[model samples]
Target: MAVSTLMFAICTAIYIAIVLFLGYMGFKRTKGTEDYMLAGRKVHPALIALSYGATFISTSAIIGFGGVAANLGMGIIWLVGLNIFFGIFIAFIIYGKKTRQIGQKLKAVTFPDLMGKIYNSAFMQYACGLIIVVGMPLYTSAVMIGGARFIETTFSMDYNLALLIFAAITAIYVIFGGLLAVIYTDSFQAIIMLLGMSILLIFTYVSLGGVTNAHEALSNMASLVPASLASTGMTGWTTMPSMFSPIWLTLVTTIILGVGIGVLAQPQLIVRFMTAKDDKALNRAVPIGGFFILMLPGVAYTIGALTNVYFYEKMGKLAVAAAGGNTDSVIPLYINMSMPDWFVVLFMLTLLAAAMSTLSALFHSMGTAAVNDIWGRWRNKKPSLAETKAFVLIMIIVSVLLAYIMPGSIIARATAMFMGLCAAAFLPAFTHAIFSKKPSTRAAASSLVVGAVAWFLWTAFVHIKESEPLGISMLLFGQNAILPMPWQVVDPLVIALPLSIITLAAVWMVERVTTTKEEDAAEKAI
Candidate 1:
């Protein structure tokens, strides 16, 4: 069932050519710093919606999370609902419109710039930017690993070579054309992804003899559930895992809520709102964004779960077993074994699109943080497009190097860990900034510090999934995690995000009370 590598290479070349052409168009349109950094705040509504959707649904979401769906069952569909609800509807209607208006009024160019300007504090800008510069690479490197690993395996190329090629191609556009180029190429890539996933869904359901039969067949395979998974509460491919079981906690908290709620504060995603011209654009984009988000992960997760029936029928083995128990390999293995030769090429393009779209946005966000927020704010200077581009190249190199250092398992945790961190560090303060008329700088600072610190401490000392590998807890306390059973299994986001919000609310109230008392004393003296 292997397809022609030469054919894949040719199709990939054409895809890359179109992407580069779009990037070139973006560069042509980019005539000022605003154009380069914020797409001139005049991007088309459809383009904004498509680019935002593309940036959110990366290769990790499609392949890694899809593989998760294959192994963990259709229960992961909960995340799809949250994605549309929070990632699109709420993000655009509640956050995106506000962000657009405020960002335009303040002339904010990046997420950190928005924060710094809103607070009127240079320290706020630097700290936000610093967090992005330091933590974004963990997510960025995970993305690089996903895309490059696919290229290496699919075309039989060297991993290092694949990594370099992916990095260089994405960097060239982002560094030269900036956010304008990133969005332009993103819209183009989004189309490819939509087409590719649409085809994947049709092919999967049709090949399984139809939707009803596929579900029935999969449900029948409940008895085929591996003993290992059953012990952890897996019921079947179609049902949710046992409530409060280890699997349930991991699925619901770590996978579902960690990413679902975490999407609100993603620096790269928030930056897309700043690219909008007005509330009208954001309002118009809601349904478009919602539909785009639905098609991408919705199709991936559904097709991923149904892949079990296909494998069971063809190989008499389940999806995970068919791929030799490596969940990461499940989707690719299914495609190679079951899909048509032409579709293989298209799917490969789909993955590349997912990777490039997200990567370009990450590069832009990181670079802007470095040049515009951190360095420029510190020096009290306005950064030029050239300087930001240089920093973009630097961040790209940093992320590529980190990809070599980090393990492939980061893919599974990429969305959860990175988004969790962003939510913990920025979400509360970001919410306050946009919604509160008289936001407290002290409260914002304290929340950022507390949230980030709490998230890291929990990851390093309490979350067994992360702590066990980190070995920090074992090194310090002779244990993998400081807690036992359910506590160890619970995700950091669940612990840290609430703590972050509490810290913000507590401090803001304290400051408000203090100021009110001071004003009363002054009035008595007068």
Candidate 2:
């Protein structure tokens, strides 16, 4: 106990010192709203890439989703592919240059600002701002919960206290130094996370004897898939289930597609494009960001699946049962039981780096939305630097309170729900704004409402088996009873996103035809 306490204290001191140093540097450079909010629009591309990668891949990827992969098997690797193709490649090459150019053209500093300028609507600005203000905290709370849970598991501290401490430390840096501080710390945290995961992977492989032995051990446990889940075409981790089964639906839709395409619409990530110094900077950052995002999650998930090798060999049970059958606890249990004391200390720092890096970005985005988008719009004024700083404080306070009060499971579910909703709500409007000419404001506004409302309704009523007629897809197909079809499992994004685009195009066509007829009548009368 004494040794563990001393190790914890030492790791804590190093983390705090590094963060405070970054905060001081940010404070020294920060001069105006531009500096605080967008890193004065001069951040180098490498830093931008690191910042974007770190913010996008957080505790949710490492701890939360890693645990999920440990239970579900290699099917989740589909998400890693999606992250590479959609999250980094297309997002940077296809969308980054245009987004940066347009943001500079309009002097837009936040996502809401970009939306408002594109649509020429003050109402859109406020609406987007409100969405960020309300929606982002749910994501933030999940990150906090993941970090706190790991800390609680390792240190045996009260979970609420762990949550508060994690939230408070991140909030302080974010509140003081804003975006520049967040990115700087993120760069450092990303390095730590990369090193830590690499070490964990190496150790895990060594513990299992080698690659071939690990595969053999996993294959021997093929019958371990729970009986209740067997009828859904669920197979064990050694192989993939039949295509288009419930297991496949969860893997393809929820874990893979939900997070993969969802990356394009992430506000926190989009703003990082504006922070880069130039197109060259964006170009420089791409490989760096893509490499880190791919490697870290890939390693973590691979190690997570190998937990079965250790658990089955030593304990005569799966890691899921070894961790008391809680999916979220599997990774923690493996780390605690398999690693030595020294590496355990490093793992704690790695978890902290992951959680704090992501939390700082979320807080920065939320505060900017509140100060620059919502309050500034309502007052019909631009916020002073001092006012923006105060708004940061307010956001930190609110987020910390939510972290302290909310359940971890609830936070995780809500965070996933928000990501799906954001994809639905903003992807269409954003795509049209950048690529389409003279997009109808009526279409943009209506689509935003339809997407948000549809997501909420589906989440509340249709998605649940017990609440409504069958499942979500069944309800859409006019089925009043449960459908056993794999495709019948509907994620809100798969439905709401297509509906939003259809609504936007349909509305725009009707308005365009009406305007053309009116113009013809006016010319004839003249």
Candidate 3:
């Protein structure tokens, strides 16, 4: 066998061995549903931090969003700031502690369970569970696609085969070991990701003749912005797109706000708060999680934008152009061309680590939501671990099918859509569940239904890319959209989130007034 191939195979085996060993350890220690679902709420602060970070920043951020950076330029860095601020800082500091407290007090094991119990409504759990089971596969499929794309580009494997392999490996640990295995493996993967991304950043800058030189070259090439993008207010790589332009609206509102604020409502992420031992653990994890978040996107987005310069120098073509206009291909193609063959092997593992860590968490979340929150609630019984594992296998199969059928360059949009949906549907209700004293069940239910439905309708009819594919807009509204350009392109969250908040507030106020009147009447009679 060729030396490089042999070395790669050996390294891959070792990595797999380490991951499987950790999964087994988690499995051995797991004793019950609590252990499986939340690691008995005794996970180390560092493990919780690392697992949360790893799960949050998956191949979607590294490969899909990285490719976007290559096409969109440094302006995408704004998202990094938002991720650190909203995703890590606000998530852990403002929400994490209370979520853990409430989760523990209520003995809630999952996000849906927490919400349902807090609201004292079985229907709430069913609704929340349904939202997760239905919406998460879109995000999961995006992650699968990101990982599969790397494997396809790196090893010249069939995309479908790569996806199945990826899903199978992730499912083995997650379905068997549950969240315990998922988080333990996630910590291991997080380490690999940090090293790989650090090395990638240094190598990227060195290859471009240092940071200053790279930025200068990239900045000077503003004229290279494609006419298609330029028409949509793309000024240059370094600067933000024109304010209120269709492209600008999509980037800031949907891509940035949707994913950024949406992190607060993500069940997979929210469950991490419950995994920690105490408020201190959650607090201690804040900076550590923040650092990881800062590093992943800070490095990935920077390198993604800088790749444009590398492709321009090496191939005399832009990164997107050389990759045949496929945004998803930009990262894998850049790595193959610019880095050493050995590094390619290592980087491929890094991407695998990223994809697997996230896929495991997602699969675990979906499985538990399907079985414990949805089915178990309906049956008025607790589901056994084995039953949950069976459902996990089903979820994996469905997500794999989605990964196979989703169109190219669908990764980023899918991630954004799922996050946007969560933000609209769950954020208002979730926030109130944690903080409000008299959170009305009716209000929460209305918000969940209205927000989700609004987001879906907007995507089907107004989100230009999805609208055309779904053909709802074209079929109903004709050639021109029912909404105009900026409105059509603006993310659903911008519109739907406010509606959800309004619904929640309006319902809650009415409920509160009625309760006060009834209490007053009873007191007077007494």
| lDDT values for all models | 0.89, 0.81, 0.89
For model 1, residues 1-526, the per-residue Cα lDDT tens digits are 6678799878888888998998998899989777888998888999999999999999878888888999999999999999999999999999999998999999999999999999998878998999999999888877777777666656677988877988999998998898999999999999999999999998988988898988899888899989998998889989999999888999999989988999999999999998887889989999988999899999989988998998988899889889877676778888888889899889889988999999999999999899999888878888887888889999999999988877654676866899999999999999999999999999998999999999999999999989999999999999999999888888999999999999999999999999999999999999
| Model 1 / residue 476 / CA error / Å | 0.1
- Assess the local accuracy of residue 82 in candidate 2 as a C-alpha lDDT between 0 and 100: 88
RMSD of each: 1.2, 3.2, 1.5
Tens-digit lDDT track for model 2 on 186-220? 99999989999989988887889887888777777
| Per-residue alpha-carbon lDDT of candidate 3 for residues 1-526, written as tens digits (9 for 90 to 100) | 1127787789989998898888988889888877888888889999999999999999999998898888888877888888888888889888998999999999998999999999999888999999999999999999999988987877878988989889988888887787889989999999999999999999999999999999999998899999999999888888888998877887899888988888889999999999888888878888888899989988988898888899999888988998899999899998888898888888888999999999999999998999999888988999988888899999999899888789989888899988999999999999998899878899999999889999988888887888888887788878535787778888989999999999999999998899999999999999
Scored by lDDT, model 2 comes in at 0.81
Give the CA lDDT, 0 to 100, for residue 48 in model 3: 93
Clashing pairs in 3: none
Candidate 3 segments exceeding 4 Å error: 1-3, 524-526
Candidate 1 versus truth, CA RMSD in Å, comes to 1.2
Clashes of each: 0, 0, 0
Q: If ranked by lDDT, best first, what sequence of candidates would result?
A: 1, 3, 2
Ten residues in sequence with the least summed lDDT for candidate 3: 1-10
